[model samples]
Target: MASDLRTQDIQNPVDVAEYLFRRLHEVGVRSVHGLPGDYNLVALDYIPKAGLNWVGNCNELNAGYAADGYARVKGISAIVTTFGVGELSAVNAIAGAYSEYVPIVHIVGYPSTASQKNGMLLHHTLGNGDFNVFSKMSKEISCAVSLLNDQHEAATLIDNAIRECWLHSRPVYISLPSDMVQKKVDGDRLKTPLDLSFPKNDPEKEDYVVDVILKYLHAAQNPVVLVDACAIRHRALDETHEFIVKSGIPTFVAPMGKGAVNETLPNYGGVYAGDGSNKGVRERVEASDLVISIGAIKSDFNTAGFTYRISQLNTIDLHSYGTKVRYSEYPGVRMNGVLKKVTAKLGQLNVEKGPKPNNDIPDEEVKSPEPTITQAWFWPRLGQWLEKNDVVITETGTANFGIWETRFPADVTAISQVLWGSIGYATGSCQGAALAAKELGIKRTILFTGDGSFQLTAQEVSTMLRNKLNPIIFIICNKGYTIERYIHGWEDSYNDVQEWKYKELPYAFGAEKDSVLTYRVSTKKEVEELFLDREFASGDTQKLRFVELVMAWDDAPVALKSTAAAAAKTNAEN
Candidate 1:
C-alpha cells in the first residue's frame, strides 16, 4: 500500500491528534461524527488529514447516535466533541452504545492542559473549576478512558483506548487537550498497527465445552439453534453460521438477533420471542428436547417480556464470555472457539422427524373494501417486499416491535435497539447507517420509524440530504406514541404527537426536486401499489425515498401488545 503521496514517514513524528485519527482510520472509520466547537476546532483539522471525513452533526447527541449506527455497520466508529457541553449532550448516546455493545470512540477536545491544571474559567465548564467532572461521569459507561494531557504518552494512550473500544465492542472516552493537539508523538508506532486481534481461548477448555454441547446435541430427539444479539455484536457470526449450516438443526433468532441468521437457508426458522413468535415457531422451539442458544440476551423485549417457556434444564447457553449447559456453568468457555470446534468435530445428528420451521407470509387481502393498513398485514408483507443485502433500521417504538414479524433477505443487516429502547435513535442512526452503506457502495439503506420518535431527531434527515446519503425512510405516521399508549395512558393526551408533512421533508431539507422521491400511502392498496412500483421497489439507490405510512393510532403489532402488557405488569407506573 506504499505510495508516492509522501505519507507520514515511519521514522518521523506525528502530532498527537494525527496519531489518534490515523489509528481510527486504520480500524475502518471513514467518517468522524461530531459538532465543531472552539476547543475541538483545531483537532478536527486532523480528521481529513488522516484520511477521514468530518460528519458535522446538528447536535452532539445525534452525532453519538450516528456514530453508534456507523459502528454497527462499519465495525467501529468515532465522534469528536467539545469538552463539557458537547460531551455531556452525547453521554446518553454513549451510554446507549455501552448498553448495546456498540463500539464507538468518544473524543472530547478540552481546553489547553495549562488552563485545566490552573483552573481557568472555561465557558463550557460547570463553572466549579473541576475540569475532570465530565470525564468522571463518562468513566462509568466507558470501558476505558484516555486523557491525552501529556505529549510523551499520547500515542500509547490513544492506542490503548482504541484497542479497548474494539476488544470490548463498547464505547471508550479519549480526552484531547487543545494544546496537546499538535504535540509530537512517535509516528513509528503507527507502522505497527494496534494489536486488534482477540486473545485466543484456551483450546483444551473450548474443545471440552464443545464435547459437552455435542453430547446433548446428539442425544436430543429435537434440537434448535437460537441465535441472538451477542452473536452479531460479539462478532461470532462466522462460527455461528458454520455450526448452523453444519449441524443442519432448525435455527431461530431472538428479536435483537433478527438478521443474525440467513432466512434463505432451509434450516433457518423465523423469530422466537416466547408468545410473540411466528405461529408455529414458539411451539416448535419450546417442544425441542435441547435448545442450543448462542450469545442470547433474554431481555424483556428480546424474550417477549421474559415469557420464554423453554426449560433451563433443556437449554445449553453459549456466550461470548462463557458457556452454560443445562444448569452447570462453564465460566470462561467462550462460544466462538467452542462453536467452531463443535462444527468441526460434529458427525451425523439424530434430527428428530418434525414439521420444518417456515416463515410463511400470509397472502395480501384483495377484498379489503376499506383498504386500511393494519400492523399484522404490513409487517408480514414487508417480509415479502424486502430484497437481499439491504440495511434496514427500526426505531424503538412500533417500528421496532413491528419489524419482528418481517423476515429479512440473505445478508441483510438489521439494526435496532431492543436493550436500550431509545426513541429518537433510529433517525440519527439511519443517517449514519446510510452513510456507512454508501461508503461500502451498498445499493440501499432503509429505515422504519414512528413519526413521534422521528420528531425527536428529525433534523438528521437534513444531515443525510446534506451528505447525499440515499436511505429509504418510512415514517410510520400513527399520530403519536402508540407503543407508549399501549403500555400506559391509552387515552392520555401526553401520548400524542404533532403531525408533520413528512413526505415533503426531502425538498425542505434542500434535496433537488428530482433528486428525491416522496410518497404518502394511507391504504393497503396504496402501500401495495407503492411497493409494486418498479422504480421505487427496484435497487434505485440514486434518489432518496421518504414514505409517510399512515396507520391507526391505537393499532400495534401482536408482539407489541403482548410485550407492552408484560412490561406494564412488571413495572407499575404512578
Candidate 2:
C-alpha cells in the first residue's frame, strides 16, 4: 500500500486536476462523461492522461444522464462541465440521480479565485458579480459540496467529497476554479485508498433486531422475501440473494427491483405490483403470514397508486437508513450488515420450503382478428426473445409500465426511472449504458421507448452511432402520449405529437448504411418475423438494430390502465 503513494515526494506535487482524476480512477471510474467548455477544458485534458476515457457527449444534460447510467453499473461515475451555462444545464439530470440514489461526482469549472474576489462579471455568470449562486442552487440536490480555494486544503476536500458520494450513494458537487487546475497538491495521498467501508452497527441493537426478525421469521407459517430498487442502490442485492437461497423461501421483486435477482430460480415468483402484479404474485405475497421486504421504496408508481393490500403489522421492512419490525422502528440500522447476519444465521434456523407461488408465464392470448399490434400480444412475445445478461433500459411512459410484464434471464440488468418519471431519459442513458456494458464485457444493450419520449432527446442516438456502440432500440410508435391519455385526458388534443418517420431516424442521425439495421413492423406477424431473424437475435456488437413497432393509441397494458385510473381518480378527489 505504501507503493500506492506517489513515487515522488509532496515537494514535487502534481496538479490538482491530475490528483482528482487519479483518485477517481482508483475508485473505479474508468470513463468520465462531459462536454468541453472553456472553464473545464484544461481539467478535461487531464482525464485521458490519468488513464480514464473522456466520453464527450452532445450536451451537458445527456452527459449527466450518461454519468448516472454509468454509476449504476460501475459503482461510481464522474461528470465535468463548465461554469453556469454547462453546470446549470445538467440540474434536472443531477436531481434525478439524487432522487434515485445514484452516485455521480459533478465537477464544475469555475472562474479563478482572483476574479471572484475582485467581483468581475464573467460570461457564464449572471452579470451580478456573484459566482456563488450556482453552487448555492446545487446544494439542494447534492449530498456534499466543495469549492477548492487553498492548495493545502484541496486534497482533503476532494477526498471528503468523493467519500460522501460513495457513502450515501448520491450526487456530490465540486467546483474547480480555473486557476487551481494546475496548482500543486500532495500526491502522497494516492498511496492510501479512500475508506469505503460501511459504519459499524451498534452491537446491542443489532442483536435485538436480529432476534426480533428471527422470531417472526421462524414462527410464521408462510414467509416471503420482497426485493426492491434500494437493494440495488445499497449494494445489498448479493446478500439479499444469498438470504433467499439459504432460507428456501419464495421471493418476488417489486417493479423498480426488476433484474436485481435471478427470476429463473425455482422459488422465484413473478413481479409483485399490487393489482398490477402477475397472476398470483399479489395473492401469494399478501397471503403470507410474514413478509421480509428488503430495500423497499414504495412509491406511487411502484405500488400501482397504493393498490397493495398487505398489512403493515405483518411486514418487516429493511431499508438503507434503518429497519422496521411491524410497529417498532430502529434508526441507523444498516441493511448491508443486517442482511449479512441474517444470511449467516439462516442455516441454523428451522426454515421451511414454503408453497411455491404461480411462477408460470402464460402464452400470449390473441384478441384482435386482424393481426394488429397490442400490448397484451407484444410484451409476452418480447419476453421470449430476451437472453441472459442483456441490459434493458425502459423510458418513462409506456415502456416503464409495459416492461413490468417482462421476465428477465439470469444476470440481466434492468434500468428505469420509476420514481423520478423523467421522459427522454432512456435515449441519453442508452448511450452511456451501452458504453458501460462494453467496458464491463457485457454484450447486448436493448432499449424501449415511446415515440413521444424519443422526440425529446433523440440526438443522443448520433453520439451512440459515432462511438460505434450497438444497442437495439424499439420505438413504440403510438402517435401520442398514451400514458398521459390514461392519466388525465383520454381524447384531449394536448397529448398529441408530431409524427415522424421513426425507422429512418438512424440514417438521419449519421449511422452508416450497412452498419445499422432498421425495421418497421405494423402488424404482429411483422414483429414476430423480425424478432425471430437469425442476425437480429444474435446480440451482435458490430451492428446496431432499430425497430419501430406501431400500435393502437388507446390500447395499453392492463396494469397501466388500472394505475392510470387510480391516479386520475385521486387527482379528481383532491
- The per-residue C-alpha lDDT of model 2 at residue 160 equals 96
Q: Model 1, 1-574: lDDT tens per residue?
A: 3422233333687889999999999999999999998999999999999999988998999998999999999999999999899999999999999999999999999999999999988799988889999999999999999999877778889999999999889999999999999988888888897898877878888777888888998898889989999999899999999998888899989999999999888788788999988768898899999999998888999988888999999999998789999999988878888888889988989775433443354554444455788887888788888889899999987888888878777999999999998889999999999889889877889999999999999889889888888788999999899989988999899998889988887788788998888999999889989989887876665788899999999889888999999999988845
Q: What is the Cα root-mean-square deviation between model 2 and the actual structure?
A: 3.3
Candidate 2 per-residue C-alpha lDDT over 160-181 given as tens digits, one digit per residue, 9 for 90 to 100: 9999999899999999999999
Which run of 10 residues does model 2 get worst, by summed lDDT? 352-361
- What local lDDT score does residue 535 receive in model 2, on the 0 to 100 scale? 86
Cα deviation at 113, candidate 1, in Å, is 0.9
- Listed per model in order, the count of residue pairs whose N, CA or C atoms clash below 3 Å is 0, 2
Q: How close is every model to the real structure, measured as TM-score?
A: 0.96, 0.95
